[model samples]
Target: MKAKVFKYKSDGNTVVASYMELEPYAKNVYLSLSRKNEDGNEDDDCFHVVCRIENVYFSSGQYSRRFLKGEDCREEAATYCRNWIADTLQSAERGAFVNLISVRVFEALGLDTTSLVQAREEYKRIQEQKRREQKEKEAEERRVQEEQHQWLLNEQKRKFLDGERITGEMFLEITGRDGFDIHIRTKGTFNRHVRGIDRNGTVSFRKIKGCRTPDFTGCHKAVSAYLAFITEKEGK
Candidate 1:
């Protein structure tokens, strides 16, 4: 594809350029050239950029010297003609715009095409940067979700251990209810502790859940001391 740059008289301020491509197998692009001044009148010696800016034009069989208007460029637009415009590759060679208008005036237009390598390189760099940013965003989201899920699992584990110990404690308390009337019995007739194996290597712990129902509101340290006493004195 090839691109050209010029100012169109229809819209003077905007820099107008188009890309064009001529398919080798099909009809070649048609064009006609003319010269004119700023007053919209035909002249032989007008500004080259303004005078001969018409890139493509058509005729019945052979193109006469008649300079077609801008809108008449699409004499017979072809599929291959779409890629033959300026802006196809984002830029053209220096002075290419000036020569492009003259190129289409030929009958069998066999012209070399150009691609803007500089624009392609810049576009690739921008795509890589966007990919990096997207990866970082997804990683942060996954990390936050994992942390919250782990916290919930640990909380559930703590609750489960607490409830098991409290259940055992309540059972022991109820069994000793009827023996409250006995007096002056033995040295260690009733031991109210149980031992359980854990990753901390038989560490002492207290019942947590169901503590209020059994009226067993021992502080953490006091309950730990009770577990130590039971394991030592009761030989468990």
Candidate 2:
């Protein structure tokens, strides 16, 4: 079942060119949202009548598709378009239908109206290059910060386990992403972002506080968990 296609000119008349149709898809294919027949063994997703405007040789524009047996969507579509045609014809005669999105205005607006699309392509390339540079810079900064902060966490863990004092070198190793390492350690590491300490004295752990419950329970185990986790990792 194809969709009912209608064309309306400046004259108050409509011509049926073609129509929308709904048909079943293959096993591998899924049905569209507004479909008549569902897909797969589950039968949830169904098929739909997708209508597209096609250009003929000289006359231009027709619509086509396969027909499904269930509903008369084409008739519904035709009815929907009928009102639009009536109003559009009235508007066109009064010349109240100026198109701001036309290529004429697009060209005037200094947008890329070139048939070659050279300017648009160049702009796209420049944007892509800029994105790549930004990503690389971000990644490089991330690497440096990770190395430094990991070092700080390691030192913290070292002090915690060895029962020693937090030292200055630990602070120097951790710096990046808006001093994230600092804020976290200050918060008291016990969260998801912080974990893992390398033997070379690189450490990372979230300085998460305890949960809100009776006795401020399940808190203050940040260092203990880190130590246990490190010990477990070392054993493995």
Candidate 3:
């Protein structure tokens, strides 16, 4: 697999200038270069190259090797690190376990592994923040929908209380009826039925059928207005 290179800033004197991951099994193998001297002084003309596979230093307890400031010197150190990663991958393929690490070994070396730990914690925090934001957004949308439904119910009830002329459909909505149907007869008569189910599963049916009154009267005007409203609503 192709290697992925990255960098990390640490609290120690050295900064991880270059980091690489070659393969899944070889992910524990780390390589980095720092530009600080042994006495914690910044040295522009020197680079400290360190290579390790999970606490076992390839340089045998010497954490790093010094390289002078030059393109040739930098490339030489990078080539060695890449070769070391390739060797580690071959070793893993031969049934070598590369995923295990010993805390005691790490403590003995006094290696600073805080950069990787902090990176994982930062990623987890970001994911949790996104989850919280999504939940809040969904809750706000439900609240707005409930408010709109309540406003519509109040408006329909006000029209009924104020003695205003309302369609049969409006009456059904205001009373929370589940369904309704209207049938107009040929002799200028009509049948209107409103149906609903109560909390105890009891069916309630209201039928106002065959009213042979004038078109301007109570039930007649309401049914006529409901038919007109439905025709306009359906574009029929």
Whole-model lDDT values for every prediction: 0.36, 0.39, 0.42
- Where is model 3 more than 4 Å wrong at Cα? 1-112, 163-236
Candidate 2 lDDT by residue in tens digits, 181-209: 33345334323333443323345444448
lDDT over C-alpha atoms for residue 127 of model 3: 72
- Candidate 1 stretches with Cα past 4 Å from truth are 1-26, 29-83, 91-115, 164-236
Best by lDDT: 3
Residue 213, candidate 1: how far off, in angstroms?
32
Task: RMSD for all candidates, in order, please.
Answer: 22.1, 16.0, 19.1
Cα lDDT of model 1 by residue, 1-236, tens digit: 33332324344333334432212222444332324345654533222112121453322222222333334444433333544444333344432222323233222244444333334445556777889999999999999998876665455335433543332333234223313222212111223333322212232344568653222223233334444544564584
Backbone clash numbers for all candidates listed: 12, 24, 0
lDDT of 1 at 177: 32
**C-alpha positional error of residue 210 in candidate 3 after TM-score superposition, expressed in Å:** 17
lDDT of 3 by residue, 128-149 (tens): 8989999999999999998887
